[model samples]
Target: MPNPPRLRATALTATAVLLCPLLAGCGGDDPKDPDLTAQKLSWKDCPAPSAPEGGGAAPSPLPNGGRWQCATMKAPRDWSDPKAGTIDVALIRVRASGGKSQRIGSLIFNFGGPGGSGVTGLPAFADDFAELRTRYDLVSFDPRGVGRSAAVECKNAKQLDTYLQVDMTPDDAAEERKLLDGTESFNAACEKNSGAMLPHVRTTDAARDMDLMRQVLGDRKLYYFGISYGTELGGVYAHLFPKNVGRAVFDAVVDPTQNPEQGSLGQAKGFQLALDNYARNCVSMAEGCPVGDTPQDVKNRIAVLLKNLDAKPIPGIPPRKLTQSLATDGILQALYSQELWKYLTQGLYQAYQGDGKVLMLLADSLNGRNENGEYSNLIPANVAISCADDKPRYTVKDVTAKLPEFRAASPLFGDTLAWEMLSCSDWAVPGAAYHPNVSAPGAAPILVIGNTGDPATPYEGASRMVKALGKGVGIELTYKGQGHGAYISGNKCVRNAVDAYLLQGKTPAPGTVCS
Candidate 1:
């Protein structure tokens, strides 16, 4: 997989700004030292995101003129061995807009990716949470091995461009070998470039960092908004520090009950469902669908296009070609949000006419490639964190055996996602668990919102997360809608439910349904 499971938030735009360098503190502090928590932070005006942070300008001032502040917190490089060394955890925040008396504490957000840069992500979506900003300081960060926090480096830009183009789905022995070799090469590059950091980027370690962050931020409890993979991190945090959770919301929930294989399979079905929805919606439009006559016809055309591209690639953004993999990835990226359907339609139309630029652009976004052709550390960090968290490493034989089931689930996405099982096969570090432990019995009630049409993380994950979180702790809310997340969909019901809980501590009734 060229990309790991990531949030489908707005695309981050790149711009010029001053660079804020991370000054690594002198290491070798006492393992049991308590001074780190008491260390004061010198917050300053935000700077442009580093190359690893998808390179972007400093966050703009909030509507209320509250400037974004940037800071770095020192955390143990390895939670298991705190005395070893330390790494900087990058953070960004905007203070509450309302008066001091009305302020709750900081509400930290982790917008998924396991690799998404909160320092950049928060700014892009700040307006979406303007209401919450009235009472709580909006906070977010780049977890370790992500963005500028000891970012994991693998292949360079040129090599990455090549790597992403490799045929992910193998039809025969030679192709399977090539796939395996490519995966192994990628993993080896990670080990060569960032071996030490690889073993320490697990979700559990990140959860501990959050607790330390709570102490550093002077918050009595952790009030959090976690999306996509962020929800998994939140669950682990709740499990580790149940008493410290204040108010938490998990949108686009990841099922904690499944292993990596199961998760990938679930995604196959989810994406297929989203595609079906997209096709049906397109045909139902008053202007008539430009892509096809019927929903099945649309899908059939796409399948034919992918098959044709597999045999002979089409010209994309020049020098690069739109291979079957890129087109498939582009299609999956579009499925993340209903709003992107028009683009998908356009991309498909363009591809049919032998121009792959639009589809290639969509694929580029999914791969974290910028217009400059430089990549963010998204792919590296995602693979690093995922490998460190998951244990199972599938072999080619395993994937071959499961192909039929995957295909049945999603003929469009099956082979690619099934082959993605090999992502961790050659990792340097052993994974922490088959699946995360998220049974927080006494934790604060966390609002769990599920979007029925969410492609990346299926709706079924919400109830599974609820059950896994144990009784009375997870309040499930269903949004019968399209897209990857509920709150950002601009749905009043979801927004109100989430806002009321986060802003007023008034939890929505359990089993609430929003449309």
Candidate 2:
């Protein structure tokens, strides 16, 4: 709700980065309400979850290669009072078969989103980290309002269907008014339906929940592996309980203090950087690129393509529902992961040929619209989390004033991106004050990773976070790469450096540049 692109990853929606007054400004439930406390958990009391009733054999290896189990542990909704109301945190545990007792401990993985499902990612890294798992239990969970846990379900998935289908970026005043009205309407719906849960969905609250999860897991100190917004979570934990931290790896880190407006501008620039990287590998090559050699050339072509689609929404594959906006959404999604850049290039290439199928598929995937016409809860959760975390900075006048600058920076994606949050400006749940500095002075050495050309979390952000921590080390694994949160995905030099730190408490030598 805040700006879609900026708040997207952090706030449940991954819109844009938004900063606000304070949790108190969220305005719903009383902050002093004793019932809403986040209670910390203790290991001795965190009973091991029950296995499946049938105790059937394990399933086949997963795409990322690992076996997974549904596990649960109880923690109080509020940590300050352990005796308060308890909630069950659904977890996915992937144990390592090779390492055995030498296991270092459990490593909790959070993939940002304040809503992203780390549980679903367990298998993706299972095979590669088999050794690590042998010694340590790899755990991921559905943070509150996320997957599997007591999810905050929006109106029947059908309404969400309608929500995702709406276009937020409009060209004319009439369309613009429609976009603004739609946003306020959606915000109202969430507030009325979600009730008290709306105000309590902040990152700070989520971090507190993580601390409780840590205690329930029975770890004296916490070890974490977080990506994107996950970095914020780890930072918050380190800040709250530095002494309780063990080994923390924050890849694709973000500086929570940044203003969403400036950050979005910076991100647009970062996207340009990534686009340049993609062009280097894509344009002027034998394979062929979707756009032309010059980045401006590509921008011009996309603008044309979007206009064509805007005038006539192409019927995409059955479920993706290919609209111009959806296509843009897909392109942005793939931009987050460079591995998919080729497909985008191919899709763009094909779209230039009047075949919107590939682009539509890519877009569908980005939109998380399944083949069955059912979308993953990604978009809605993205909105819910973001709106709850922060309010949008609005005023038709303010956004209009910045239009020229934004458009100049991003010819193709600028105006659309700028207007992506007309909905959150009037959001019922506003944000709390922005705390620029969130550092863990006494926490164990926290490892911060940054790729020089990361399309998502810019390199500067990682640098800022490391500097702010003051005690932690920033490992510049110059993959000289593009994409988001793929540490341990591949790249031996980078993987080994991270592996050594997690496996053994060895931090990469200062400013170590791997690969």
Candidate 3:
């Protein structure tokens, strides 16, 4: 989602940097129910889920032999031309526990991937909806080009391994060529495998699908809880159909004003911050903490390990070696949440002892790579969707020239993310219009959640979104906590703020900070 190049490691925690890319709009339309044709949805018992975390990369499919009911809704591939073709968008619904009398509305949920499968991830948040269960039928879907929907599949697991292992920090023309060739190859794989849908899966198109879902559900307005890249989709929906908005909370805001590189650079800084945080904690603990005696010491050790692995990838599992890329990926995965820092500590200890298997496995887990090397399509879908939505403002030459700044952002992760920006430079399809500005002019007050110590989206981005949104005119709720997102990380203050906003149509005062 936020990390367009999914292979790039996100240190500190999980889910990558979606809070870093997703947006808002104005109001002019009259307030009345939308009168549009609605489609009927077939309901049945839901199926079981293959994996809850989606291996941190792709959304695992719903279990073929499980409990959750599943259904399909069709939308024209090209909304502009309904005659062109059709694609299926998958949906999973948890009917309100309360009788119809208690039902307030239908709340649509999106778990930030730009590529992450909302349908596959439906169950995890089933509990998040616990309080709203009686009042809302919580529904989530795999946006086009993901999960049970028409997915974007590029390299298979093995080929993906080949592509990901390519050196991100290229020092010579040969390395640069290898990096470009890998990008070209991965892009070509996507083109070859997912060409048809690639052209149609723009964020705007997905927003249109949301409108259709709203109409089909027989609702005049939309109630949504969007996280990370989901914020992108939600923000876009608000802009496109500002009048259709109901109660919405965009937790972990993504500054839609930022282009790909700027967002990535910001994320680089966030990861650096997370790394420093982790290092400080690790050093303070001393024993069993492999990072070192001080934050600088920890940082240098990490750089040394990456350099060593880059020169010589150590043996990992039988077939998979721990390359610099995988090692970095493992590190980044830990950065997504503070909870994973312990695992990072253990992995680093093993890695320092010459056993990279632990770190490599950690990387695999984040990328949704199963033990058998069966990779999930999350990365492929992420690339496809992100490329469709964004085109780099800088040329490949420009990106390379900007390396110093990227490096200056985070010595541990700078180039890894910088090189990743090249994927769209030679994308198979041209991207949509560039600028995304969301001032949500006439819409009801919207809540933008920001974690003060968030490593992915960063706190200032939230403040920026609110300012563009006209400040309290476009509200912001702060979580003075650590991690990529605050709402779902057991922070009652953040959760209550979100609940109050969605359930009671309440907005916290501007600059309200929750610890």
State how far residue 427 of model 3 sits from its true place (Å).
1.3
Deviation in Å, model 2, residue 202 alpha carbon? 1.3
Q: Tell me the TM-score of each prediction against the true structure.
A: 0.95, 0.84, 0.90
Using lDDT as the measure, name the better of candidate 2 and candidate 3.
3
Compose the digit string of candidate 2's lDDT tens values, residues 1-515.
22244333532122110000012211112124333233343222212221211011333445545556666556455434446665666677766555556867788988676566555544434555665675688888777666555455444446655555566566678877766776666666666776556655666666666766676666777889888878877777677666778988888777566765665666666666776677667666775665776656776677787888777766566543556776676577657766677777877777776666777655545444444455544444556666666545556666777778777776666666667645456655666544333566656787888877766677778778887776543444445566765474477777887889888888888677755
lDDT of 1 at 503: 92
In TM-score terms, which candidate is top? 1
Best by lDDT: 1
**Candidate numbers sorted by TM-score from highest down:** 1, 3, 2
Alpha-carbon lDDT of model 3: 0.72
Total clashes, candidate 1? 0
Higher-TM-score candidate of 1 and 2: 1
Which ranges in model 3 have alpha carbons more than 4 Å from their true place?
Answer: 1-4, 7-36, 48-67, 286-288, 470-473
The regions of model 2 sitting more than 4 angstroms off are 1-66, 78-84, 290-296, 319-321, 435-437, 472-478, 486-489
RMSD list, candidates in order:
4.4, 6.5, 4.6
